[model samples]
Target chain A: MKGTLIKTVLIGISLGLIWYTNSHLDIYNLSIVNNIGIFAILALSYNLINGVAGQFSLEPNGFVAIGAYMTAIFIIPMDTKIDMYALMDPAPVILQMQANFPIALLAGGLTSALMAFLLSVPVFRVRGDYLAIVTLGFGFIIRIFAMNSPAYTNGAMGLNDIPEFADFRWIGSITIFTFMVMIHVIYSKYGRAMKAIRDDEDAAVAMGVNTFKVKTYAFMTSAFFEGIGGGLLASFLSTIAPDQFTFLLTFYLLIIIVLGGLGSMTGTLVSAIVIGFGLEWLRFLDDNMNIFGYETGAHPGMRMVVFSILLIITMLFARRGLFGDRELSDILKSKRASKRKDA
Target chain B: MSKGILKIENITMQFGGVTAIDNLSFEVQKKEIYGLIGPNGAGKTTIFNIITGNYHPTKGEIIFGDETITGTKPNLVVQKGIARTFQNIRLFKSMSVLDNILIGFHNQSHYSYLEAIFRLPRYFGQEKKIKAEAMAILDEFDLTSFADHKATDLSYGNQRKVEIARAVATNPSLLLLDEPAAGMNPSETEDLSTIIHKIKQDFDLTILLIEHDMKFVNNMCDLVTVLDYGEKIFDGKPADAIVNEKVITAYLGDFTHA
Candidate 1:
């Protein structure tokens, strides 16, 4: 009873804080906050497959891309889409598709989930490193298909004038929702089955966990959230191109999950914030530096170089990540126990 | 003895060009602690794998409780009342002992994903019941104190016991334990022997186990099958198998007077 009360109070406080920040923060800071919230959703879902299920899949980019395109197509006005389709005539279905913001977001998520459902038939046939290779290839294939499909996707030109449906309020609430859902799952029987598969697939099978079914569910759920995140990203930017949804996006998420701790939800949440803000804060590294009166020329992509070094250093020092498969709650509980022991 | 509950007839397992088990056959009676003993790589574990449906026999059939379980998926085999432990202690690492045991009840919990996600009444009710059952199982094993500890952090004997508890949580009529006494001290092994017997009586489980420890097998098994190169060399009483010339020769080479 006490625990539930504490949790409800904490959630109330968090929602209040979000409301305050949404109204008070400037556009620049608000955008950064929104970006972090979206990434948090993406990373949490990705962790279900990569960290929680212990399936090394690299297909988030493809699903996210599908989400962005699907949402963009549904929400964009037919006239604006016709104007945007410069290379060729838009598909009849594309021009006909119309939905409100919520329905469009749902459409994006469902489409990505459908793709995941189809992909699981082939993707789950392989495990370990083979699964990683197959999914990486899948990411590449999505990008290439997007580049080639002009009628539906606008080819290399991408889409513009995406309705600004996603804001601090939507992203913030959804992030919290995603986090809570993930926690509920991690403590549920299905999550236990996934972890059993992760620890030992054969043993999990012996224990009567249908590994394939469990894996598919995890994959679909992950794709669903990734798609939603993608939809949010598209609306927030009001523009998206094939180039924006590349393997690099998946790579950034990968780094975030790894830095957070693979199987720890709290760790992923913290790392998403650190990496999200760190990426933006590190932008100054790319500009020309007048250090000690010695002007260093502006080095484009220098931020990436710094990030790589930091990742390497992190790997060298904390290989299992910040939490090492443990939650923040677990750490706190143990700390409290120790304090009582001292008392 | 009553009719056999499990029958493996002419089971052969081949990996590409290499034949791991060549025409192995055995029968385990209902509620008996059957032992499959052999030297290293003598196809003992192979038979366990074949029975559990991890690897389908190249050509043979396995009948479990009048059902042709041949080529069944591993999870389906478990659902049909067969659970197993690994030779290398394959507990779900980083999970608490209670959670690990709860996983064995995975198929038993029938709440839909929707219920689980929405925290429906059925979800809470079922989860609470399963958790209580898991605690009871832990208490039965005298592992209730360690219920919240990470399963991998327990002592080796306790880890093996936890694995057994997990398998038992599945409510299997037939339990396959691979080297249950593999790294235990004599006292721990003795404790394991008692636990196995108690489990057999309490759960009415027919146990088929693979162990290199002769003493452990001699004390625990009602029937013993000795295999050499995947061929059954002896199938009879444990004492007779120990005295059999062929079985002795298979384990220790022919005596040479020097």
Candidate 2:
């Protein structure tokens, strides 16, 4: 009873904090906060497959692309879509696509979920490194499809003038929802089955886990939220192109989850914030600067270089990432126990 | 005589060019503790795999409780009232002992993923019920004290007990144990034998076990089947197996008068 009260109070406090930040922060800082929220959603969902279910899949970029395109097509007005399709006339299906913001977001999620379901039949046929290779190809295939389909997607040029429906309110709420759902799953029976599959697939099969079904379920769930995250990204930026949903986006999320701790959701949350801010803060490295007395020209991708070095240092010092699969709550409980022992 | 609870009919398992089990046949009566013993590479574990649906037999069928279950998936085999343990202890290393056992009740917890994610009433109700049942199984195995400990952190004997408890939590009518006494000391082995007997009686289980311990076989099994080169060399009383001419020759090899 006391534990439940404490949790309820904590949740209330956090929600209040989100509301405060939404109302008080300026557009620049608020955009960073919204980006972090999207980051949290994407990383949390990705970890379900890569970390929790223990399937090394590299297909989030594909699913996110699908989500972004679907949501963009649905949310854009019929006239705007036709005007935006500069390469060729808009496809009849693309012109007919229309939905409210919530419906558009849901459509994005469902389409990606459907894609994930179809992909699993072939993707799950391989395991370990082969799974990674097959999924990486899947991401590539999605990008190529986007690039080739001009009538629907505008080909090389991407959709623009997307309505800014995904504000801090939307992103923040969804991020918390995603976090809560993940926690619920990690503590549920299906979650146990997932961990069982992660530990040893053969043993899980013997335990009647239906390894394929559990894995597919995890994959679809991961895709659904990743799609939504992509939708939020599209609306937040008010533009999206095939190029934006590349392996680089997936690579950033991979770095976040790895730096957070693979299987720990709390770790993912903390790492998302740290990496989100860290990336922006490191932008100074990309500008022209003087080292001592020598002036060097700006390096466009220098931020990534410094980021990689920091990751290497983190790997050397904390090989399992920030939390090493232990959640924040578990650490707190241990700390409390030690304090009591000291007393 | 009790009717057969499990029938293995002429099951042949072939992998590429190698034949693992050739025309193996066995029938385990209801509530009987049956033993499958053989030398290393003699297809004992292969037979267990075939029965548990890990390997579909290249040729034959498996019948459990009057249902033809050959070539079924491993999860379906467990759903059809068959559960098994591995030759090596394969507990989930990251999970607590309670969580490991709760996984055995995976099929039993009749709540949807939505309910679980949303924490609906059904989720809480089923989870509470299942956790209690898992704890009870642990209590029966005297593992309640280690319920929250990491399953791999348990002692070897306790780990074996936990595995058996997990298998029993699946509510299986037929239990397949692969080398349950593999690495136990004599006292641990004795305790294991006692616990196995108790569970067989308590759960009303028909057990088919693969073991190298002849004493364990004599003490626990009602009947023994001996295999040599994937062929049944002897099948009868455990006491009779030791004295059979073919069994002795199979174990010690044919002696030449010099």
The sequence of per-residue lDDT tens digits that candidate 2 reaches over residues B1-258 is: 789999889988899988888898889999999999978888999898888887888999999988999988889999989999989999999888999999999999999988999988899899999999999999989999888778998999999999999999999999999999999999999999999999999898999999999999999999999998888989999999989988888788888642
Clashing pairs in 2: none
lDDT of each: 0.90, 0.90
Candidate 1 C-alpha lDDT tens digits along B92-163: 887889999999999998887667777788888899889999999998899998887889889999999999
What's the TM for model 1?
0.96
- Over the stretch A144-181, how does candidate 1's per-residue lDDT look in tens digits? 99899999999999999998989898899889988888
Docking class of 1: high
Tens digits of per-residue lDDT for model 2, A242-262: 999789988999999999988
How high is the DockQ of candidate 1?
0.84
Q: What is the fnat score of candidate 1?
A: 0.82
Q: How accurate locally is residue B44 in candidate 2, as Cα lDDT from 0 to 100? A: 94
| Error of model 1, residue A151, in angstroms | 1.4
